[model samples]
Target: METVLIEHFKKARRLFRILLVLALLCTVCIGIAYISIFLYAKIAGPPTLTVPQTAIFYSSNGKVLDELHNGQKRYWVPLESVSDNIKEATLAVEDKRFYDHNGFDIKRIGGAIVADIKAMSKVQGASTITQQYARNLFLEHDKTWTRKFQEALYTIRLEFNYDKDKIFEGYLNTIYYGHGAYGVEAASKTYFNKKAKDLTLSEASMLAGIPKGPTYYSPLLHEENAKERQRIILNLLVDQGKISQKEADKAFVTPLFYAKKAQDEANAKKQDASYFMSAALSQLTNELGITEAMIHSNGLRIYTTLDIDVQKKAEEAMNTVMNKDSDIQTAFVAMDPKTGAVKALIGGRDYKKSPFNRATQAVRQPGSTMKPFLYYAALADGFTESTAMQSEETTFTLDDGVSTYKPSNYNSYYANNPITLAQAIALSDNIYAVKTHLFIGEHRLVETAKSLGVSTPLKQVPSLALGTSPVRVIDMVNAYGIFANGGKEISPTFIKRIETAGGDMVYEAPQEKKQIVDKRLAFLTTHLMTGMFQKELNGYTTVTGKPILKYLSRDYAGKSGTTPTDSWMIGYTPQLVSGVWVGYDQGKQIERVEEKAYAKKMWALFMEDALEGKKKQAFKAPKGLVSVNINPETGDIATKSCSKKYKAYYLTGTQPTTYCRDKGVSEEKNQAPQKQKEQDGFFHRLRDWF
Candidate 1:
């Protein structure tokens, strides 16, 4: 019995010794692992922060229009520039115990752990503002034990390295707000179109509540959720003694102010001035080898050629006219003829619904709108306005004999009429135009259009006379601008200049001029086309109550055109050239002239508003041009008996050699004849016939 007892005791002693050795080994391994992790965390650098370039659009006068971004990227402003209310709200909501706690809040963390265990879910987070800043700036957003350990260590380093204000500023500037906004500066500007320094107490509280979960409490996406979060933040502010109970109560009742509607947001986004200035900035940035980071974080101050008032008016006109219960989409382009600077441009009604900028991207047949260019080309080709063309019905088969096309006038009744060159263009007789185009080879016409800055591909066909070829709105507007600029083709420019954030002028737009046609021909064509306003105005005023003709005090030229699908009205003064296009995006047929509302209404509104203060300027005729009276229908020397007389003007190079001889007729003869004379004339004609 004694021997068995001794054996049992020895076995128990051995087991106890083994258990003690295992415990010591486990402790040593854990200690080494922890030390290894600590060393790794110390050596590992922060993630490389990649900020995206915030796209800004500015009006011509340098007002911000819009800001665009693909992610939470924006211009970061300093803490001093941020409003005091926003700063206080941020401190109150993000870290109520921030000033009192060390790098780690032991009590809060302990309570959070207990609560998490009891709830069987992680609900509360005990990270201080300093810790959160350190984690966001220097650590990845992982919620593992290892990541938390690293965060705690970095928090200690951050609190030691940075003061409270510095830490708070960093937090305010680095935290992400919803809607692709980062930092208080960007959020304030995005929501209110103001800087961070301009935020009110309510606005500040609303902004501070967003960082808890940006998308979850986004004012744009979840307004009620955002309001709830704001209430919680206001209550916290009151509890933390940052604000009085009454203040909290008032703030809680305050309705959270959100950003404008989508349309207004789009307009607000335009204020950035970058979209119009991007081309120029790209050239400058490339020349300077500017990195992407500098472009985004530097908060660049760009000055552009955009006139803010003009752009606003243009946008308003386009929106008002295009949205009038019609399916038609409209585009408007305005440019300075002398400088070729595009002042205001609205590509489409809404870019979100349709990103295809009809002004820049679409290519369609210009219909009779192409007649001005054709006339200009003919004048350049030694054809005078008095030159007559055979307007008989005609058809032409392609040289390959695979296809045949016939051109007809808009009225479809002047097939056999002998129309003069001036009459052909003014009346937009397709047969006469086709015959004239045939007289001048297709290649020469193409060269003429190309010289005038029509960069689109032109099909060599008889239908080209009626604008069957696809042409972009920019090209068409610039082509018309040639006449306005006295035949000098100036490249259209959207940007005026580009500068760095340090106020360094990186690039300035250069003026480029090239004479595309004869100056005399340009002036002569402009003079002849000025009559179109009188003709088209009669049609427009009969439909709409507004008389656009009375608004044009000077001799301005304009033309209206419609294909089966698209309608266009391109007109110009001496200083400005505006082109408006209206049609369905899918190319539906325009029922009639009355139904063509988009282009005409948009054009009238834009012109009336754009030229408000500017003086009415007339188109100047070049040095050697003369206006003579000729027969209206025959386009020949006027006769005394001919009651209708039209002014026939000619350029120096293409003037009429035979001046119209006018028989001397008394003023009474020119006036209305007596009714008795008309009855006597009818009786005399009947007796002579018998």
Candidate 2:
């Protein structure tokens, strides 16, 4: 019995020593951990809080236009902006001991380990709010020891540098709440169509439940599952002493209204300004050398040149005038002539049905709109507004001598007499245009178009003068802007500036100008285009713009073009330049007369409406141009006695040397043709030929 007592004493002594060693080892381990954390805190610096955020786009008027993001949309709001209910509900559901623990809850983690061991799987999480935020900001959601270890280190680092409120705010902002929503604010807006600060207890509880298993608890997808999870969260809130039992019961039974319905879900995929936003994003990525992935992830603030009011006017005009049932499509673009800013643009009638940006993408024949470039070339080639050409039917022998080309006027009607450049333009006289195109050489028109910013490829064919080559509507608008802006070349600009999420400047557009067209020639060509609306310029045909003249309240210089498959009207005032194209996408003939009329009528309506409440300014003539009264029939300086005369613009040395011999000419000769042309209404019959 003594020997047994000795052996028991020895065993007890060994057990005590083992306990003492363990205590010392644990103390050393704790010291080492503390030292490592201190070193890491010294090295890691401040918390970056880097997370993907939604990029916002603002209009010129400082209104939010749209937003872009990755699959998950996040809008960061300060802790002050989040409702107390949301904070309470999130704490109850996600981490109850959030403020009590530094970065990890020892008791909760021990409980979670026991629970997982009982389940024989890693089926429980004990992450505190700070740990989750660290994982969200720095680590991926991989179920591995390495990820967990990294998450722990990051959590310690975060706790060391940031206060509890900052870490909480970051967690609230970065946590994924499902359905393409990455934060409390985005979730609130997505589910309730309200700001996060406006969420009630019921809505906050509903949103809070989604973060655990986003897809499983999403109110939008699984309503019953979401309700059950929300009820659980409300009970947790009540048990945590954050809310009363009556409040929990009331929240659980409250009738909830979701922001999105089945149809709304479909419609949300396509919103207003989809086309314009797409174009701006394209420019941002392609032209500005910014990658789309960066744009999606980085919180960028893009300020665009879009005038929201003008954009609305453009849409209203298109819808108001267009036949909604018709399949014929149209594209429109409006710009500030001086600055080259694209204030308004529409790629197609409906962006959802089709995303083809016809304004910048479609290359359709410009028809007679090409004449301005051609006429501009003529003016540079020493051809005045009074330059005369025979408009009778003619076949041109090609340089090869074996080939001949025949071009006819609209409706095969011709002046059958010599008509001045101004009259030819007003009539859209194809015969005279082709004759002049050949006389000056087709290469001249090609050169002129390029100088005016036409980037599309062109063949030096006689029809080039008549705009047979296909060109983009946007390019045409910019080209017309040169004429409207007194010959200064301007690029079509969308984004005015870009800024980082932190308000650092990324890019600011430079207001640059290049003189491509001579100011004198641009003014002279613009002057000739205005003859389209003047009744005095009528000769073999009524002016092409005569049909839309009654719709105009301000002076505008423009041209109209027609092809078998396309109808175009591009015009501008000094302040704005806009273009419209109407046609079938398949290049089918525009058979309907009303469809043919759509371009001009739409242009008239949009310009009038868009420029409303703004100053009505006239086109300013340059210093060297002189205005002269000329006889439309004679292309000669007009006398007071001349029966019909109109003001024409000429360069100082380019005016006609002869005066009109109208004193002895018969009244029938002078007045009869003008009356006949108006009565015929060449543009009224444009339906048959346009």
Candidate 3:
């Protein structure tokens, strides 16, 4: 028995020796592994921490107009800027031992391993904050053993390189929050409609709860789930001794003011000056030679000429008047004629629905709005405002194709005889415009449009006189502004300056001006344009017969345009030039008969609001424009004895030399018998040649 006991003791001793050897080897292996990770991290250096900063847009009023973020909507804030409540809540919920652990928690990892083993899938995560930061910053989201091994390796590296504060800041700034928002600042703005620094204890706890499962705990979506998660966080805070049970209960019953998800989403979508910022950024992108990613991430400050009041008014005008569900889109652009500073731009009914800036980007037929360009071309040629053209429809064979084009009046009612050229413009007479366009040489008209800043293509077809050529609203506004400015053309400009976050001025838009036309001719054209809204052009009923002037008492020149699908009302005061376009995005013709009145009324309301405080402005008549009395029927100089007479404006040499025949009251009496019938306002049922 003693011999057997001694042998057993020797066997046990030998087995204990073998087990000691294995334990030492495992300890040595772990030490070497840790040392290797540390050395590798030291050699690899800190991970690239290029967190994107928010880009701010300032309005002319010095108020923050908007902010632009990266694709993830991330805007990094330093650790010091974070709310203490948020930090404690996040620590209590995400990683209580974040400062204690080197990179990971072994007990949590063991539990996760057991859980994953039973579930046969990654149903739980054991990553500490540092480990999560490691996976998010440098590693992938794969759940395989290899990815886990790599994640562990990176976690060790991060712990070796960065402090706890840095790791925490990066994690808080990069973690995904619900509603497509990333980072605490963005999340706070998105979910609470406030800055992250302003987050209350309850709000911070709620936000801190979102990072674990953003979609599942979104306060905007899963309110009950979010409350439950928040409760869990507050309880964890209490258990972690960061707060007492009394404080936790106080936070638990706190009335939370969560951001109205739908309204918040709508506001975010309709962010202030979205279209303006987009257009301004496009201009900057070309000049700076950078992509939009750089624009959003490079921490640039854009100072723009957007007027918040005007912009809001522009939006209000369209929103108050137009049908929301009809899918009809509208555009409003207002610019100072003197400086060409674009004050307001509403690109579409909703910037979220479409970012296509119709104000400056879309090309549509200007309809009768292009007539001023034609008339300006005529004045530059030999024709005066008093020059007469036959108002009846005339057919012209196309030189380019086997087709004949016949242009008719929009109202389909003409004077049946020759009317003065000024009358043609006031009436928007298509036949008279076509005749004058052909007479003035279509090429000359194109040159005139180009000189005035209509940069789109204008095919020299016979229908060009009736605005068949597509042009932008900006182009039309700029062109009309030429007359408003007494022939000096100012380029439409939006951005005033751009600076870097470091206060380096990158871009500053200079005032672009060019003398594009004769001052007298531009003045005469302005005079001719005002006739569209006058009760009569020198005692004869005009085609428009005061359609717009009846709505507003301002002494301004303006015109209305319509295709089957598009409706336009553009006008200018001496102080500002404004244009509004109403149409469908898909080019669907307006369905309502009240469409024109709605469009015009919107224009009038906006103009009234815009010109409210300022004294009414008047266009200056440049030198060398002649005012003369003429025989209404003869289109010639009127003798004092001629009873029927009309006032006309003309260039110095373009005034008529002829006089009324029979030279007396006998002939004037017969011509003056009928008071010109008050012409009905033009409905603009255009002759759709397409």
By TM-score, who's the top model here?
2
Evaluated at residue 427, the lDDT of candidate 1 is 58
Candidate 2 off by > 4 Å: 1-34, 37-47, 113-125, 200-206, 215-258, 261-271, 320-322, 400-402, 512-514, 663-690
- For residue 240, give model 1's deviation from the true position in Å: 9.3
Residue-by-residue lDDT tens digits, candidate 3, 1-690: 999999999999999999999999999999998788778989988777675667778888887787777446666778888889999999988888888888879888999999999999999878799878777776677779998888877787778888999999999987888776778888888777788888888999899988888889888778899999999999999988898999989998999977766656776655468888877777667655656777778677888888888888877878778877767777788888877788998888767778899987998888888889888888776667666656676777776667888776765776777677766777777887887777667897788889888899899867888888889988888788878988886877777888876689988877766777898888888888777765545323455635556668788788888888888888889988888888877788886877765667678778888888999877777677678877654566677666556677776545555566532222322222222111111111111220
Q: lDDT tens digits, residues 1-690, model 2?
A: 999999999999999999999999999999998998889886987679878889989999998888788578888899999999999999998888888889999999999999999999998888899999998999888889999888888898898889999999999999998878899999888888889999999999999999998999988889899999999999998888888999999999999998867437745643367778888988998899878877888888999999888998999899988999999999999999999999999999998799999998889999999999888887787677777767799888888998998888889998788788888998899987887787677899999889888999999998788888999999999999999999997888999999987789999988888787799888888888888888998777799999999999988999999999999999999999999999999999998889999999999999999888889997778888778888887677788778678888878755655677682242223334554454335323422322
Clashing pairs in 3: none
Better of 1 and 2 by TM-score: 2
C-alpha displacement of 417 in model 3, angstroms? 6.6
Q: Worst 10-residue stretch by lDDT in candidate 2?
A: 663-672
Clashes of 2: 0
- Per lDDT, the best of the predicted structures is 2
Over 645-680, each residue of candidate 1 has an lDDT whose tens digit, in order, gives 677776532333332344222222221235435434
Q: What lDDT, from 0 to 1, does candidate 1 have? A: 0.69
Ranking by TM-score: 2, 3, 1
By the TM-score metric, which is better: model 1 or model 3? 3
296, model 2: CA deviation in Å? 0.6
- Backbone Cα, N, C clashes tallied per candidate: 23, 0, 0
What's the TM-score of each model vs. the native?
0.69, 0.87, 0.74
Q: After superposition, how far is residue 495 of candidate 3 from its true place, in Å?
A: 5.5
